[model samples]
Target: MQKLSNLIGLPVLETVTGTQIGMVEEVLLDIDQAVICGVLIDSENWFFKAYGIGFEDLFSIGRDAIMVRGSEVIKDLADLSALSSIYRLQDLTSKQIFTETGFLLGILMDVVFDVITGEIRAYQVSDSIITDLLYGRQTMPLPQAQVIGPDKVIVPDTMAKLLHAEQIL
Candidate 1:
């Protein structure tokens, strides 16, 4: 498992030529499906357009970098329809998370996902900055049902009872 936020700024490498194509700028996710759609690669050049690589096109996701089979897998974000409608990871942060019964739980902090399968396993949430600094963020398993709206995320009410606060040392 990997935290989606950690992927940001990691190099995107082309395996065939061992060239560094770009850095991971953002992770694109299908919120309703709770799966990563792909990533946006920053070419770091004003003359170049950023590219998108679907999760399926990745050769491997390593601790140090993300590898692609070759430059062929990289394409203009406009051309990658699978990522067209997805939300960037950064866009979800600070969005209020609520229970089905309308109880305010917290806000989205991060996502724990399977690096190999791109499946979202859990969500790290923060009630407030003070709570986060004292108890750390709470981690909750992906609920059976989730609704992502323009301004908030709603999960099953049972999630309120299941959230586990991370121990801060």
Candidate 2:
């Protein structure tokens, strides 16, 4: 799967019409599903904006292109503003994880998403086996997984407790 950051600057192309719509400014987060919801775009045609095209008409697009089953392209420019208000993946990385017993686990390092559903599948810890193989022992994996906000990812209390006890190993 591609990292959310990779899509940040990639041009959003309309596969159906082969039109270059715009570049992705930010990815909207679906808090309910703990996954990416859509891409926010910047459609500032200088002349159009000068003639009073609103910002809302320039910034939002649907996730249809990212969906494997969808064929529809986002055509409405008015809905673009809604994307700016949605939570982003960057927001989730800032939250802390705590166990039911109130132990502090590590921060969220990454989110694993299912390609088919575009839903979050698991939490990847920085110090876990994968991270150890990639980075080294100064890191330890923490257990906590939940969505706190559009950008806030929280670790579940139950998992936090298990991790606190070192039972995850």
Candidate 3:
């Protein structure tokens, strides 16, 4: 399982010309559908801002860098402007987790996913405690999200523990 944080700042390389394009600034996700679509390539150019590319354009996502087929696959359109309003991976942190039966679980710490498929595999729930660094915090694996909303995330009651954040280790 790979954490979403690992993709940040990874370099993007074009395979056709074998040229370095830029680094991955953030992973673009489809929140409602709960799928990672692509990445926003970091750029320093004044005229050209972030270069966005979809997963279909990717040759491979590797340990070293993100590989693309060519420059043509990159998108610089304004269509993605509204994506900023959508919830991102960063927003998941500290978001309350609610059960389908209406119960608060804990703060979401990290998400685990399949590297090849870009599917969210499991959630690592935590207490957000500094002492958790030394002693392990109680965790519950949320296999999938039932609903992702502006203020909170809902997972099936069966998947997560009933304990609250303050109750966990």
Candidate 3 residue runs with Cα over 4 Å from true position: 46-50, 77-86, 134-145, 161-169
The full ranking of all candidates by TM-score, starting with the best, is 1, 3, 2
Give TM-scores for every candidate, taking all chains together and pairing residue i with residue i: 0.86, 0.54, 0.74
Overall lDDT per candidate, in order of appearance: 0.84, 0.46, 0.67
> Of the pair 1 and 2, which is ahead by TM-score?
1
> Top lDDT: which candidate number?
1
Query: Candidate 2 lDDT, tens digit per residue, 1-169?
Result: 3345555665655444667656666655555545566555555653332121222232332343322111234443335324544455566554555454555555555554544455554444443566456654232233324446443345556774343212121
**What lDDT tens digits, residue by residue, belong to model 1 across residues 5-103?**
889999999988999988898988876687888998887554555478989999899989999989788777655434545788888777899998899
Q: Tell me which residue pairs clash in candidate 1.
A: none
Model 3: which residue pairs collide?
none
Candidates arranged by lDDT, highest first: 1, 3, 2
